[model samples]
Target: MKAAVAAILAGMVIAGGVSAQTAAPAVKEDFKPSSLNQPGQQFPQVNSQGYARFRIVAPDAQAVKVSLGLGGRGGTVLAKGADGIWTGTSEGPLDEGFHYYHLTVDGGTFNDPGTLNYFGSTRWESGIEIPANDAEFYALKSVPHGNVSQVLFPSPSTGAQRRAFVYTPPGYDAAAGTRYPVLYLQHGWGEDETAWSNQGHANLIMDNLIAAGKTRPFIIVMTYGMTNDARPGTLPNFDVKPFETVLVKELIPYIDGHFRTLSDRGHRAMAGLSMGGFETKAIAPKNLDTFAYIGLLSGGTFSLEDVNGTPGYKDKVKLTFVSFGSRELEGNRAGPPGQPRADPRVNAEALKGAGYNSAFYVSPNTGHEFLTWRRSLYQLAPLLFRD
Candidate 1:
């Protein structure tokens, strides 16, 4: 009877162990189908040749377009599978420089959730870094770099403080015995002193050009062009003449006194874009004793009549470089259907006839865009400060 009881107790213990094992909860799967909503998962890796296949997961959208400014537009890509993934290939052995692109989903502007954003000079958090075959233009080389300082100098003409950005060339201090020429660069409408460095990439462009021995080592001073608080694209309430005076009388003197600059007309140059270009034309010619080289990129008062009619205007200037994007002609001209307005090209030709060391460069297939201006800057720098 005792042996029977021992067997029954052992069986009961075994049964309890089996019940406990079966009662344990099963391991649950934490995976969710909605976690695949990320759009970047479809982006293709950019190759060293600057070619990349871009993909977007907008399965719900009917039409998707990629607006590549000056880099060529991408084809309409369709969504694939039930996952709503839209995929397209961009074949670009692109230019060896930085490019900006955005997505247009059914005529609406949208930043790529996956790629990087380069609106102006500031790099946004989202962007894909593309390695270039020869990134000397955009790459950070071992060459000596310069410092860009934003400072306020007292303007005697205006009796107010004015802001200017100064760029000291590499080895400026080390080469104490040597002095450098200065370039007064002005910004266009709706932009201030920071426009050059921020949007124009002036510092990088200058550094790269100097590193490649393409441009002479010089100082660049960028200042605000507009003096009045006028809405952009409209005429200002105040005249820009005072601002020009501030530059010539106050800014130049202060810069010369503070920095190691060749403080004479032979070593000084002035150039600008749009309204700034107009200022360059208006100011530089009037003060020919102060500026030797003048560059007008995209917009300026280039009329030969204006220059000749202006009092005391002569061939006192050394070199004048004029450039315009092809697309700007349409808006710059005005006339009725029967008779078209005078083209600025005629003015450019007249300047050439006036025996000014003048040259006009027209960028093909480009509009009044920053790309044209940036390219113009790259080409124009080498021509400056030449013996």
Candidate 2:
């Protein structure tokens, strides 16, 4: 997510909506098929330095461009060769972690045939992974794995059945009567329930955390954040009441009745990223009785006034975790040109000074992207439900 994006997205989600090149060292010859590629397909490869090289076959095309790399440039333009194949390398190394991109082939947009698809920009686009140095924390090791299951719960407010993904920790089924804490995680705008599981790998992160005994086992519930109402860049006009009703009145009841959750505010948590973060900042403070732990990952902030203004924030909110990408704080202005940027660090400090349970974190060397949110979750998880 860009700073401008986070600015325009501050109001509501409303349903639906880069690394520097290394020194003159030789490009490591260890490029391999992107982890996101389909089976037996290769071409979109990333070297150890995070440079992505692409080869797209277009026999009868005029132009081919990969919509990634070099945040400023219009993306990498591949040159046609004698063999009718178009190939190119990113102008510079990309930031580590998953990115959604598309191919602009001869003025027509399409997905790269090699890589798997991820839902972003309200569509399924090609995804690529530039391995992160700290990827091991979310890697699938020999540790016990959890299962992510899809569920359909009825929502009287929406008058339709809504879908959500549930993550049951390893041994959750066998343990039978053991109840676990719950985290109601939401995705950014232009994403749905699958974003956290497929792109963010929430299950893997939790599994690794639990296997190492770094954090207690918990259930994660993810659903479409009801952001389809307003168009992008018009989030301020979006209404959050409809979505809040679905979550508070309908979905929580369904999860409590079906899953072996602790079913209490003390064991329940809520967090989101980007527009999802905006949602969290909006709902969590107002409904402290429902969510004991609140986390805002590159979403927004809870100022001293926010805690002071809310009814039960001081005693009810067990944890107030605020985080952002180190890069997201680069500029003096955190919002648009006119709006004054609210300093999250100051707010966090003030909250703590006032005897509130507040924690602040910054993801190193990342932007408003999944790498930031992933690290935020890893840090926030350990602090949640401690009471």
Q: How many clashes in each structure?
A: 4, 8
User: Can you write out model 1's per-residue Cα lDDT over 1-387, one digit (the tens) per residue?
Assistant: 122112212211111000112232432332221111235354644444444455777877877765542224343353455677776544333333334456778887677776534432122312343343333463457777988998899976766888999999888879988889999998765457876775567877788999889999999999887533544223423366788778988899999998999988888999987656766876887888899888887654356776677554555666778776554454422122234344557776887787766767775534444544666687788888887
Report the C-alpha lDDT of model 2 over 1-387, residue by residue, as the tens digit.
Answer: 244345736422111105544564566778888999999999799898888889999989999998885652478899999999999988777778878889999899999999899987788989888899999988888989989999999998899999999999999989998998999999988788899999898899999998888898999999999886556666666677898999989999999999999998999999998878878888888788899999988888888877888888888889899898776776643466566687889989999999998999998777767788888889988887675
Q: lDDT: which candidate is best?
A: 2
Could you tell me the TM-score of candidate 1? 0.65
CA-lDDT, candidates in order: 0.63, 0.83
Stretches of candidate 2 above 4 Å error? 1-17, 20-26
Could you tell me which 10 consecutive residues in candidate 2 have the lowest summed lDDT? 8-17
* Per-candidate TM-score against the hidden true structure: 0.65, 0.94
